[model samples]
Target: MEKTWNNKAWFMVLPVLLLVAFSAVIPLMTVVNYSVQDTFGNNQFFWAGTEWFTEMLTSERFHSALGRNLFFSFIILLIEIPLGIVIALNMPRKGWGVPVCLVLMALPLLIPWNVVGTIWQVFGRVDIGLLGHTLERLGINYNYVQNPMHAWFTVIIMDVWHWTSLVVLLCYAGLVSIPDAFYQAAKIDGASRWAVFRYIQLPKMNRVLLIAVLLRFMDSFMIYTEPFVVTGGGPGNSTTFLSIDLVKMAVGQFDLGPAAAMSLIYFLIILLMSWVFYTVMTNYDAER
Candidate 1:
């Protein structure tokens, strides 16, 4: 007997589709309209073809912001992935310690993005902040407002603190899902601790690791709130990544045409990079 296909499920999903179109699709179309056209006061718009796109692509500001975004994202992935894996591996697999470890790992991820930025902003002030005051006492010239390198360092560290927990949680979930039978077999075979982790835990965690890496990369690339609050893209734009620069162009300078074009380009870049990451990792999973 042939099975009948289900058509009713799509009706269940129709509301969600309409919601997405309303929320995402409509706004995106508005941005596209702005991107290809020029606007003046009084709601007047004129066709500018690709002028804004061309100008954005050729601008030195765009290049600098893009480079900063790439660099910050790369560094975040590098530090967070390994650090998370190590923390996950060390976490207790059972007993009372498990809940404690899990809660600790989750605390950073629970904070709102803007609140995290606010907390850090206050926490890093030279006179009032614990971290900055301690550094000052140690005779370290650690001023995020005055020094570009210090500003970058503080922002990177803040991000690592806030988001590394996500990677840890993902990896921990992957680790915990491994059956006890596998560990029993490894034990029976007299596998070393290193060998067990290398062959068993690492392989099991690969899928989650890929997910963690991609999430961190995308979030870090588009980071705005925390960095904005902490550094305000200060010290001559040293820590101003693409998101910050885009906001400055759009809101601060009121250059809607260029800003819209830049935003679309930024969105495309993120989409393309994420697709590449997903494809490569998925292919690797398939191969293995």
Candidate 2:
């Protein structure tokens, strides 16, 4: 007997498709329209045909912002991934301490991004803020508002504080999902802690690690709110990543055409890099 499929399920999906079209697709099409055209006001638009794209591609400002974005993402991954794994590894597998640790780990993640930035922004000030006051008393010249390096440091630290919790949670979930039998067997084999981590835990957590890496990388690359709130892309544009730069162009400078083109390029770069990350990690997982 042949089975008949119900076509009604697509009707259920139609609302979602409509929502996506209204929210994402329409705005994207508008950006595309603006990207290839020039406007001098009064709704008058003329065909420019890739002029904005070419200008953005060859612009030094674009290169600098892209470099900062890449470097920031790299630093975030380097610090967060290993730090999260180590924290997860040390967390209690069972006990009253488990919930406490988990809640504490989650607290930072629960804070809104902009609030986190604001908190750090004030906290890093050299006058009334506890951290800044303490540093000043300790004879350290720390001021995020004035020094470029300090601004970068503050941004990096704020990001790590806010987002590392996410990585920790992901790693913790992966750790908790492993069967006790694996640990028991490793123990019976007299495996050292490093051996257990290397031969068992790391392999078990591969998928989650991949997830953590990708999420952290993308978030760091596209970081805007926190850094913007904290530094306002100041200290000589030292912390101006791509997202911040795009916003400066679109909103601050009102260069809509260039901004639209840059945004498309930004989207493609993220898509391509994410694909590369997924492919490489999945292939490695397969090989192992």
Candidate 3:
């Protein structure tokens, strides 16, 4: 028997496809155009080939920013993944406590990005802020404004406070989705808590864990507003990441050509890394 496939469903999705092309594709093409060209004024552009790209590739400033971005992402993943898992495991899995815990976890995620930055910016001030004042009273020499290490610490803690909730929620959802029968079987086998988590929970959470990792990695890599508000990439470029550097080039210095080129490179790096992450995780899941 010959089976006829219904192709009409594509028509329903055509509107969404057009919306994406308009919002995403057109802007990307514009960036690609600027990346290869130079313009001074009067809506004029001159082709400079790949000169901007080559310059960015050779620039030490770009290298430093890229290094900062990679390091921050690595630190975030290291801190968040296991911490999220632990918090999720400890959270109440049943009764009214479940909803209360979930709401609290979600509160941080509800705040706007800029708002989070602003909150941390003032909160870390030494004189008037509770955290800074408490630290000072405790004889701690903490000053994010002048000290690079303190700046890094403040930014990291702020991010953890804001985004760890997301990871916790993801892991918690994964944990709760497992059937009670799994726990019953583990109990029948007289499995220890560690063994149950190591085998049943971890394997069950693998798919959501992959999603959480990818999401966190990409967001951390492209982080901008919060750090910008808090540090302004200050204290001598100590905390400047790729997104901040790109903004400095494009808007701060008006170096649109190099900025556009850098933006394209940044986009490619993210695309490539995300593909690599997806491929590796899916392969590992398949093997397991």
| Deviation in Å, model 1, residue 22 alpha carbon | 2.0
User: Evaluated with TM-score, which candidate comes out highest?
Assistant: 2
Q: What is the C-alpha lDDT of each candidate?
A: 0.94, 0.92, 0.94
Write one digit per residue (lDDT tens) for candidate 1, span 5-118. Answer: 978878998999999999999999999999999999999999999999999999999999999999999998899999999999999999999999989989999999999999
Candidate 3: TM-score? 0.91
Clashing pairs in 1: none
lDDT of 2 by residue, 174-249 (tens): 9999999999999999999999999999988988898898889888888999999999998888999899999999
Model 2 regions more than 4 Å off? 1-14, 281-288
Better of 1 and 2 by TM-score: 2
Which residues of candidate 1, in runs, are more than 4 Å off? 1-17, 187-190
Q: What's every prediction's RMSD, in angstroms?
A: 3.1, 2.4, 3.0
Candidate 3, residue 113: how far the Cα is off, in Å: 0.6
lDDT of 3 at 272: 100
What's the lDDT for residue 94 in model 3? 90
What are the TM-scores, per candidate, against the unseen true structure?
A: 0.91, 0.93, 0.91
